[model samples]
Target: MAPKVLVVLTSQDKFPANGNPTGWYLPEFAHPYEVLKDKTELVIASPNGGEAPLDPGSAKAFENDPISAKFLKENKSLWTNTQKLADILPRVAEFDAIFYVGGHGPMYDLHSDANSLVLIQEFAEAKKPIAAVCHGPTVLIKAKSTSGEPILSGASVTGFSNTEEDQAGLSSVMPFMLEDELTRVTGGRYVKAAQPWGEKVVVSKVAGSGSTLITGQNPASATGVGKEILKALGL
Candidate 1:
């Protein structure tokens, strides 16, 4: 049997402010999917499951980008029939590792989801690799240890930066500043690229748990994040 990895996506489809459409950012899913699918038995799960929405602007790939195009072409059902997080949550230990894809969507759903927080704790306690990108890191803010401590306490990580959020024209629309939350969640270093939209990836360890985290700064950092995950898994 092949190594199995769980990919959790946000089920939220509307932005909080005006109920504008939003979902998992595609390239963030695509690049990582391309990298992991070839090496592991990738399974898709989500908070609500069934047809995770794709951000309109993210549904298409650059004509020259093969990986994104490949994911769109090959993983149609995997995206369309995503299993519910509740289904996967109890079995997180069965996976070699777990990844969360980001978009504005995660901010609304995965951020506070009880199931997601439990899955995060299960993965972290077992010392499995926990990877997330962009706004997906919001889940980290809600996850706590058995001692009721922030899971990210005293660890290095990065996510969609405030600068990048502003650049994307959604600074005022987001619920809370992601960078600020990440910085405060851990009291550890939370640095970003010198400029917005630059590719940045950080591989950090949990303060007490032996688990390692691999986080990417933005969509452009997706592939890099995937590569780091493979390295962490010894693939």
Candidate 2:
């Protein structure tokens, strides 16, 4: 049997207090999806089951990209019937790894959601390779080790930076600044690229666990994040 991966997305469609709409970032999921689909089986899920909104900007900008195009062309059950996080928990052990795709929506939904915490915990306990990019890494905020330490504590990680968030013009609107929260949680290293949108990928093997926890700084690092994750999994 092939390795299986569970991909989680945010259910949030509109920002709080009547802010602009958002969903999963296309490139972040596309690059990783295209990279791993041929080699591993993938299951797409959301905090809430069913349709997942796509970030209009990312969906529009990358509409013509081969991988993104393919995702749209093949609108199968995978696209329409996203399992709820709880529904998949029973079978979480079947997965060899897990992924989280980012968009502004994750800040509102995945960042502090309970279901996400459990899913992250299960994957970590199973010692699977877990990869998240951009704001997707936001979900790691709730993941804790067996000893109840933050999953990102002492682990080299990166996510959408405060500088990049400012570039996106969402510093004031986002619930809490992502990079700032990440840095606080890790209390170790939270590196980012010198340039806001530049690519940066960090892979850390948490001591005593042998599990690979990988993160990408932003959308530009999506493919790099995907590749590093596959490498960590020894593919």
Candidate 3:
């Protein structure tokens, strides 16, 4: 049977602070989707089910990226008609892995979403591969293991850095800095590339469950994160 993977996106269409439109970053989902779509069965999902919004900034910034562009042109329905996260929880076992696609949106929603925490715990306990990139790792902030410890505690990981957030000029609006929170939860085990926005991928085994936790630093690393997921699954 082909390996099944759950690709999760944020349902938040706007930032709470200013109503600025925000959703899954285009390249973050598009690049990884491009890499994994042909190799696995992907189930697109979101917290609220339908109409996973796209960050207009990301769409414009990566408009020239052929993979992202093609995905937007041909796969709009996939994201627009995503399954609800709560609905998928009952059948999480059917998936071999779970991937969270990042954007500013996840910071406001998935980071503290109860269903998301449960889903992450289920995958972790099952020893399945769990992957995220950029702010996608925000979901890991509140996720806990069977033992009640932060899922990322002591796990080497990377995500959208503080510098990158500041550079984007939305640091003040973010609920919490992703790099700082990750570093705190990981006990300083968080790692990143030498330069801001540089591509960095980190793969670590969850301490007790041995589930693989894969993360990437920024949109530039999304493709690498998908490739690492395949590697973890031995594809």
Clashing residue pairs in candidate 2 (N, C-alpha, C atoms within 3 angstroms): none
Instruction: Kindly list the per-residue Cα lDDT of model 3 for residues 47-139, writing each as its tens digit.
Output: 999889999999999989999999989999989899999999899989999999999999998999999999999999999999999999999
Q: Model 1, stretches more than 4 Å misplaced?
A: 60-64
C-alpha displacement of 98 in model 2, angstroms? 0.7
Q: List TM-scores for all candidates, in order.
A: 0.96, 0.94, 0.98
Q: Give me the displacement of residue 74 in model 2, in angstroms.
A: 3.4
**Which ranges in model 2 have alpha carbons more than 4 Å from their true place?**
none
Candidate lDDT scores, in order, read: 0.86, 0.84, 0.93
lDDT of 3: 0.93
Q: Which ten residues in a row have the lowest lDDT in candidate 2?
A: 71-80
Better of 1 and 2 by TM-score: 1
- Predicted candidate 2 versus true structure: per-residue lDDT over 14-35, tens digit per residue: 8885667888888888888878
Error of 3 at 194 (Å): 0.6
Each model's RMSD to truth, in Å? Answer: 1.4, 1.6, 0.7
